[model samples]
Target: MSVQPMLKVERLTKTYAAAHGPLTVLKEVSFALAAGESLAIVGPSGSGKTTLLGLCAGLDQPSTGEVVLAGESLGRLGEDDRARVRNRHVGFVFQNFQLVPTLTALENVLVPLELRGEGGAAAEKDAGELLNRVGLGERFDHYPVQLSGGEQQRVALARAFINRPKILFCDEPTGNLDGDTAAAMANLIFGLNRERGTTLVLVTHDLALAGRCQRMLKLRSGAAIDGEPETLAGAARGR
Candidate 1:
C-alpha cells in the first residue's frame, strides 16, 4: 500500500481585510510531503512565506481551501482542536530562538510535555538526553539569557523534539546566526531530523539552505512556483 503524505495543502489562500480592500497573501498554493520527506519554501519578504507556514501548521486559518496534516483536516477543526493537533504532532523552531527567558534550558525543553500533563523523571531524563544530543547537556541549567545565539537555538531544537513530533516546521532557523553557526545549526537540524525520522518543512531565504531539501517550492507575488525535486547534496547530507 502506498503511504499517505504527512502534510498536504491544496488551493490555500489567505486574504486579509485592509483599509484599501481585501488583501490576498497566498493564492492557490498546494503541496504534499510524504513522511520522512523534506521541503523548502523559499521566497522574498512579503511573499507570504511565513503566512503560508502559519497556515500549514494550523497556527492560523486560511481564507480558502484545505490543510490536511497527518490526515487531520484543519479547516474542519475548531481552534482548540487545531491547537491540540499542533501540540501533539507538530514541532516548531523559529528564527528568534523563542525560548522563555526565565526558564532553564531543561525546563524550556520540558514545557511541551508539561502542557500535555506529562512530567516525571522519565520526561526529565528524555529532555536531558535530547539536550545532550544537540550538544547542550552542560547548559541545561542555564537560562536563555546566559547562552549565546547558537546555543539558545540548540535548546529550542531540543525542546521541539521533546514530543517526538511527526513533523517539524522551521522558520528561518538560521537567520540570526553567523555563517559558521548557521551551517552548524543546519547540520544539527537535518541530522536530528534524519535520526528521528521526522518530516521537515523549512522556510528560508537562503538558496544554499533551500537546496538541501528534497523539493523546493518558491513563492512569488503570493503564488507558488514549484521546482523539480532537488538532488540532495553537500550540507544536505551532513557536512
Candidate 2:
C-alpha cells in the first residue's frame, strides 16, 4: 500500500484586504509531503514563500482551501485546538533564530517541554542532551547575545527538536548565517531529520540550501511553478 502524506495542502490561498482591493499573497497552492520527506519551497523576493509556509504550518488561515497536517485538518480546528496541535506535532526554526533574548540556551530548549507541562530534573537533562547533540553543551548557560549567529541558530535547531516533532517547518533557516556557517547548519538540520525520521518543509531563497531537499517547489507570482531544481534555480535568479 502507498504511504499517506504527512502534510497535504489543497487549493490553498491567502489574501489581504488592501486599500485598493484584495491583494492575494498565495494563489491556489497545492502539494503533498510524505512522512519523513524533505521538501523546499523556493521563490524570488515577492513570490509569497513565507506566506505559503505560514499557511501550511497553520500559523495563518488560508483565505480559501485546506491544510491537513499529520492527518489532522487544520481548518477544522478552532484556534486553541490548532495551537494544541502545533505544540504537539510541529516544530519550527525561523530565519532570525527567534530565541528569547533573556533565556539561556538550556532554558530555551526547555521551553517546548515546559509548555507541554513537563519539567524537573529529567526535562533539564533531556534539554541538555539536545544541546550537546547540537554542539552547544558547554554553552547551555549562554544567552542568545553571548552566542555567535551560527551558535544561536544551533540553539534554535536544538530547541526545535526537543519535542521530537513529526514535522519541522523552517523559514529561511540559514538566511542570517554566512556561507560556511549556513552549510554547517544545513548539515546539522539534515542529519537530525534523518536520524529522527522527521519531515522537513522549508522556505529558502538559497538554491544551494533548497537543492539539498528531496523535492523543490518553485513559486512565481504567488502560484507554484512546478519544475526541477535547476529550473527553480533559474527562477530564483530571474533568468
Candidate 3:
C-alpha cells in the first residue's frame, strides 16, 4: 500500500487588507508531502514563501482552503486547538533562532518538552543529548546572549527536535550563518531527517541548500511554480 502524505494543502489562499484594499499573498496553493520526504520552497523576498509556511504550520489561518497535518484538518480547529496540534506534531526552526534571552541554551532546549509536561530529570537528559547532537554540549549553561548567531541557531534546532516531531518546518534556518557554517547546519538537518524519518518542509533562498531537498517548488506572485530539472540540477551544484 502507498503511504499517505504527512501534510496535505488544498487550494490554500491568504489575503491581507491594506489601505490600498486587499492584497493576496497566496493563491490557491496546493501540495502534498509524503512521510519522511523533504521539500523546499524557494522564492524571493515578499513572494509569500514565509506566508505559505505559516499557513501550513497553522501559525496563521488561510483566507480559503484547508491544511491537513498528520491527518488533522487545521481549518476545522479553533486557534487554541490548532496550537495544541502544533505542539503535538509540529516543530519549527526560524531564521532568527527565537531563543529565550533569559534562558540558558539547555533550558531553551528543554522548554518544549516541559510544555508538553515532559519535565524532570529525564527531560533534561534528553535535552542534553539533543544539544550534544547539535555540537552545543559545552555551551549548555550559556545564555542566548552569550552565544554566537550560529550557536543560538543550533540551540533552536535542538529545541525543535526535542519532541521528535513528525513534521519539521524551517524558514531560512541557515540564513544568518556563514557559508561553511550553513553547509554544516544543512548536513545536520539532512542527517536528522535520515535518522528519524521526519518529514521536512524548508523555505530557503539559498540555492545550494534548496538543492539538497528531494523536491523544489518555486514561489512566484503568491503561487508555487514547478522548478525545471535544470534549475534543480543547478541548485544541487550550488550555483
Residue-wise C-alpha lDDT for candidate 2, range 68-149, written one tens digit per residue: 9989999999999889989989999999999999999999999998999987899999889988998887998999999999
Give the top-scoring candidate (TM-score).
1
Q: Show where candidate 3 strays beyond 4 Å.
A: 227-239
Cα-based TM-score, every candidate: 0.95, 0.93, 0.94
Model 2 score (lDDT): 0.89
Of 1 and 2, the candidate ahead on TM-score is 1
Q: Give stretches of model 1 more than 4 Å off.
A: 226-239
Q: How many residue pairs collide in each prediction?
A: 0, 0, 0
How close to the true structure is residue 152 of candidate 1, measured as C-alpha lDDT?
96
Give the per-residue lDDT of model 1 (tens digit) for 54-162: 9999999999999999899999999999999999999999999899998999999999999999999999999999999989979889999999999999999999999
RMSD of each: 1.7, 4.0, 2.6
lDDT tens digits by residue: candidate 3, 105-125: 999998888888888999999
Query: What TM value does model 2 have?
Result: 0.93
